[model samples]
Target chain A: MSTLTSPDVGRRTTGRRGAVARVLAAPLVVAVLGLVTLLWLQSIELDSIEKRTLNTDYLVDRVREHLLLSLSAAALVALLAIPAGVLIHRTNSRVLRGVVLALANIGQATPAVGVVILLAIVWRTGFTTALVALVAYSFLPVLRNTLTGLAEVDPATREAARGMGMTRTQVLRRIELPLASPVILAGLRTSLVFAVGVATIATFINAGGLGDMIVNGLKLQRYPVLIVGAALVAGIAILIDWVAGLVEEYARPRGL
Target chain B: MPKPTTIIFPSMDVRGAASGGSATSGGGVSIELDSVTKTYPGQDVSAVEDFSMRIEPGELVMFVGPSGCGKTTTMKMVNRIIEPTSGSIRIDGQDVLSLSPDQLRRHIGYVIQQIGLFPHMTIADNIATVPRLLGWSKKETSARVEELLDTVQLDPAVFADRYPRQLSGGQQQRAGVARALAADPPVMLMDEPFGATDPITREKLQAEFLRLQADIGKTIIFVTHDFDEAVRLGDRIAVLSERSQIEQFDTPAAILAAPANDYVASFIGSGAALKRLSLMPVTSADLSFGAPASGGKRPQLDPTATLRDALDLLVVTGAEALEIVDADGTRLGCLTHAAISAALTQSSPTRGAGPAAGEGVHR
Candidate 1:
């Protein structure tokens, strides 16, 4: 459901801080917990640089790659989900909606790693393969929310649009879609956040994203490098999540 | 699906609004239905069949029936939202079948109980939808939106920029009405436009809609299950039953005076006894003008109000007689308690007419 549904849809629907507050909070909590692991791996006398920037000595490059791959996947997923959502919603065909729902459920069930591996073996892939896997993994929530949001629109509003001389498509655009927007945008927020975190594992195959540090840090059993690499990826995921959530909060329609 | 160069529905003689307080006398709408039938692919029974009627332009005709009796299906057919499997419907003397479904709907306005407002859009943008769709200039659309908001009694500034969620139920319903009236189409189709509201709100809206109908007089075909609403609002109500066929299509007075069949009689029920009061105004016709009761200050009474309503004032004020006032509140006659009782317990609308409804001049 959209945050704007009830005017007070969530405990925190939208404000300057409320949207990103949770997103920012979760990663910090996880990272602070990860501090214990860091302490166990590194000696107390280690140099600050060795401890803090080992795995992520190249955070800037990795962050940009992770962002590019995640964003690209998210955009494609949106394009697919929105049209499918509209078709399933605006039309009276139940069969198509059911099939789409089932497909989305399965998409959601697919593990990010399994999908990456499947795509890598079947298709000639490195970056694109991971991108496809990320997109597929993140597709369901966006698709489901778009469809659900459209479906929840009051039918009376649509009929009123018809009475006002709007054709079916006009009614869908002018009435249904606008009313459904918040929920659909929320779906996009979820997909984008998920894609960000999932894309980090692509570094395992040299897909050349931020996941590289995470993989190398793990393999070498490095202390500071592993901590830094994991922290940067976690931070990037939180950032994208924070941004998408902000969009969802601000762009959400207030009521119907 | 390949484009069928020619669309399924067409556009023709756009309607000229018949605006006035009275919907019946403004637009000369003549609608006809002939053996209309619709059967879903898997359903054995038809939702509507052998349904036929004619309504004059500007007439506020209502379709009323029990739930799931195809009243809504029949309404949808007018706009071709649902196609007729057999038979035809004509609006303003033109064949409905010839027009493509899309074209047919554009010429008609539609409304329903849910009061569906576009939550993302402000009141002004929502009202401007049709005009915007037809390529009207943004300025023109904005001006029309303001005019409509005002016409519907919504403050242009307070409501125009606010989204649907901000409005109260009553305000939302009013906005819905305003939105339906935006394009000024000749024919407007409504299905339970006030059904979702509370009784008092529904009654207020019924009166407001009646007043609006007087002004817009769009060829209106409204559907409701409330008999009192049908009587209070419709110029004529088409009582339907079973498979959506009209049981009786006539004035409300006629329906109460004489039910067409058992279905209508039961539908009306004990309410008919109370409804007769609505038609019984304490007119000069009902006043006996008892020899001047030169006494205490007489209570004021509206000449057009029914005896049942007037009786309360007469009894509460302990007035020997009430000075009847016309529409302008000028004294026209004197209505005593006796006169009101005589008028209220009169038993029927007309002295000679029996309970066969659809008889007399209305039929």
Candidate 2:
């Protein structure tokens, strides 16, 4: 049964405190905190570290590259996963659904670096191979969630729509998708975090990302760069997860 | 089951001479089913078999049977939710099988026991579904939605934006009905539409629905396993045995006066006579215009109150008779205990058919 009442949904309380609370609740707070921490680290760093790690241009390029890699991979996975999940769910043949689900499972079960290495061998090393690897590694969560979300819609609701003369495609588009969006968005969040974390391995395939800094720092004994690189990756992952959380909240069915 | 001769029962309110109501349009299209049967892919026994009946436009006919007797299956077959393996279904002389299932359903309203309003949609959106499908103008759809919400006794301003989860079960059921009626379809199929609510709410909704039907006059096929509900609401009830075989199809009063078989008699339970009393309203009993009560606390009953209520009131008030009044409290006539008896005898079993012939009147 739906517990979502209209008054409680999408109502923005007005006041200074409410404004403060809204800002405090936003995911951008993590981004702000991460920036502050990074500045604090730079303030206390040694001269050698300041020359390399404190160069704003250099740091910005790496952060931009890392984001580009993760976001693109997430986009690719979503582009592929959602339709595949919907198709699998709509298929009448149990065998076909089972086979497609098994394929998705294999994609997730494979090790992240192993997938990258195999893709690198097949397609040659670069951003393309790393992207393909990242997409493969993050595929299951969105696909599985989509299937489960669509399947969980109440059968009686579907029957009522059909009885009322909604065509099959209309039922899916109007009823099933709206009802299942929250679950699907949660799955997207999971895939996004995975993509952010795994994009670090792309540096091994000569794809420039924050992984480049971390790997170089470890090799050259630049502890400041190493800590900053690792810290930045973790920060990005937290930031992306927070945004996805916002989207999921927005997607939740009203009165549920 | 033996094939009984076809019997045509008049609409419950045909005596009212309701000429303006479209339901009384004797020349309108009627729904007719002939030897309809449904069998599962692997099951040897058919789910419903040889179901034959004709329902007049604007009349409400109920199908009552035990669980798994295929009452629901028969209802679904009309909307093409469940296809029949053999037989023909026609609505107003048009073959149902020739139309696309979706198109056929768009012209029909449907309600189910679960009252499956979409959880994600606001009440207004839910009610506007069929209208939107029919491609009505936005302004027209909203106006129709507001009108229907009022018709169902819900405030459009308050409930229009509220989700299904915000309303009580009874309220949700009303919204379900509103949604079904949105397109103003000519035919409706209801499967235990009020079966999920509590008994008190069920009665209230039933009364309200009857009042609504009196106004709109659409052709309705209602399915329920509750015999009492069937008797209360159906203009005519179709009692089915296993495999959707019609045992008896007659008016509620007729069925209570004389159940066609032991199967239907057992369904009516032990109080057939009292059930008949429920069918006869206080207005049906002959009332005397005795001199206006000179007095202290004269018991008053509504003319629309049932004879059963009148009888019960007589026992409780310890009065020789009760005054019957209209909605405005204008004194209409006086109803006596003897008047209730007169109504009962007027519908005695001697005028009908029954298994236990000697038990028609205890007194």
Candidate 3:
């Protein structure tokens, strides 16, 4: 019996060690990338057009706007999509669940640029429209994941919970939600990174973000500005993903 | 040579004795199911039609039948997991149907074949589920969890903080049993609780459960398709047929001796006589004090072991006689094939005398 179980114990130990290594490695990798980008930028001779877009104040302002748009959209998705998914699950109506899932599929199927451009065309272009577009673009992953996670809970486990005299609400809160959390957290992480990528399109609607640098650089043919803009957006997305990964690990129920 | 003597062992008849006669033992409460019927929506035929049985307090009644016999549905109705379309269920003379289902369930311990220990919770938390739901204080709940883990033979220090997946199948099932018994509910509903275990583990668990039942005496409705398990663990085995029909509701010895009808005899299969022996302890037989003629350190049997065990030892070792010993391994006497046969003949007169024997058969 001990021989049979020893392998599982060993595997679990290695898995924990892997997670710890990842937690420590992510920040170090991000820092190195940031330093390399700074060195590369400083090595080049910048022209007037490049200097205008790449100044510290201009760059910092763009980064702030970019972070604000993506983070808030991801936050709103977490708040709205999870409950909506749970409500659809609770209704236990196949038709309603199917409808919501189909709508979510369509939302995801539509390209991020199309969503941003189309929303701006129909509604007025600005920060609000861009925020709405980012939210719409990232909603599907979290919603789909919530439904999938809940559905995947073992029926036997659910029956036992109910049989033990746990009320419907109690079972959901104590059993179902905890079991479903890992998958849900994975979905949230995906959407967070997705929001960071899509928030770049907000610049098209006259919203100020790192995308402004890219647009200005492209029009004026300033390679330095465009590279810096693209690199910073990439950096933010990676860092957000790393932080979400840490949160996912921390928030997961211990037994799971 | 010394003549054989009949040694009267106290509690020797306890296994085959009718539970109704000793219903007042332990924390058990009586359950009365009166003419309960359940018909699924859109179906004309009732799944469990007019099913009725009075389970005595402290009785462990086994519902043994083939699949789709509606046995599970009948048991589920007691705890209101599955509502009956008609009729009623009462626990300890209290109308279970009238009470709130959730509140009613909290008082009835429930176990199932799946042995569903929550994957996300530690063993302690899973066992503490009911106590916490009842708003027990943290200290009280933790103490109860520890007590239950110990009752199920899991070390609290080693197993309490571990998740269900880390445990073996047998250990997980033990945890499942521990969790059901956490609040010490008077009535327990077990749906083939040991069905998923392998044969060896199942036997060990059955023995342990029987010992536990002797202590707690909780009125339990245990469902199983295995006739051998029913005979071994149940005080009274309810041989069920289609539509949850009670073909025979009697003690294990009574049913094995005289099955109510052809269906029951067939359900009992080829091992009726052997099954009966399993219900009778080794002390039921006469024993001789004479030393074996060719003694060469003969095999010994425990005093508490069943006659079936004695027979197995005799056959396996090909011994003419085996010594019976108490827990201290001191020789009580020697048992032979003749003594076992004599005991079987002596028990024949009391066959079919169990409480509710041949009472619930409705053609």
Alpha-carbon lDDT, every model: 0.71, 0.81, 0.82
Ranking by lDDT: 3, 2, 1
Model 1 docking tier (incorrect/acceptable/medium/high): acceptable
Arranged by DockQ with the best first, the candidates are: 2, 1, 3
What DockQ, between 0 and 1, does each candidate earn? 0.41, 0.43, 0.37
State residue A78's C-alpha deviation in candidate 2, in Å. Answer: 1.3
Tens-place lDDT digits, model 2, residues B42-89? 999999988899998778899999999999999999989999999999
Report the Cα lDDT for residue B206, model 2. Answer: 96
Isolated chain A TM-score, each model: 0.79, 0.85, 0.92
Q: Write the per-residue lDDT of candidate 1 for residues A122-223, one digit (tens) a residue.
A: 786688888878877888898899888888877766666665556678777766787788888888988888888888878755587767777766776765
Pairs with backbone N, CA or C atoms under 3 Å apart (clashes), candidate 2: A4-A255, A4-A256
What are the TM-scores, per candidate, against the unseen true structure? Answer: 0.83, 0.86, 0.88
> Which residue pairs in model 3 clash with each other?
none
Worst 10 residues of 3 chain B by lDDT: B1-10
Model 3, A32-77: lDDT tens digits are 8889988998998998878788888988999999999999999999
Error of 3 at A243 (Å): 0.5
Residue A24's lDDT in candidate 1: 73
Report the C-alpha lDDT of model 3 over B240-273, residue by residue, as the tens digit. 9999999989877788877889999999999777
For residues B45-156, could you state the per-residue lDDT of candidate 1 as single tens digits? 9999878887777788989899999999988888887889999898866788887666566456667788777666677777766555555555656667777788778998
True contacts kept of each: 0.59, 0.63, 0.53
Alpha-carbon deviation at A41 in model 1, angstroms: 12
